[model samples]
Target: MTTLHQEHTAHDHEHGPACGHTPVPHGDHVDYAHDGHLHRAHAGHYDECEQGGHVAHDGHGHAHGRDCGHDSVPHGDHVDYLHDGHRHAAHDGHWDDH
Candidate 1:
């Protein structure tokens, strides 16, 4: 008889200000959760201003075409955010793989 074991490892990344802009957690932002890790929001757009302050777009009427110096990661088919130093993934609404 043969047996096999599967091991899952979780990667923890630091969370801090990105591009000199501090991320404020809101209720309207999208949640990114994957592999039992919950990261920052996906729709949160932060832009660096000339005054050295961050302007949050809140994924509303503001467009995300300009280079705002936000930390983002291309995961599989979509783009996620890097809160602080941690990469966040969008939730797929399925827990079978867990």
Candidate 2:
């Protein structure tokens, strides 16, 4: 017998710690394009190998993630942010809360 896996993506960046969900942290998430926008996922919600944040999927099931999307470095980019001061670039790559 064979099985098929379907992935559903959605945009949800407005969610913050204020919503009672812990911020998953940077570099521990993936942003997928959805509905003309990008949606981020936490390690606890996806198959993250590098970090032990993998979520087990029982045959067919969905999981809700908390605390994610803190890392902003591109896949091939070697960029590091500072603690103090902010880097203002055109479209810093973060989802604008507009």
For model 1, what is the C-alpha lDDT against the true structure?
0.32
Per-residue lDDT tens digits for candidate 2, residues 11-81, read: 23444446432333334333332232223444323221121222322232212123332333222222222
Off by over 4 Å in 2: 1-13, 28-98
Task: Report, for all candidates in order, the number of backbone clashes.
Answer: 1, 6
Model 1 error, position 38 (Å)? 7.7
TM-score of 2: 0.19
Write model 1 residue lDDT over 1-98, tens digit each, in one string. 11112222332433355423334333433223332323442223222111122233232322222264555544446544544333333443311100
Residue 96, candidate 2: C-alpha displacement in angstroms: 33
In the order shown, the candidates' Cα RMSDs to the true structure are: 16.0, 17.9
Clashes of 1: 1
Candidate 2 global CA lDDT score: 0.27
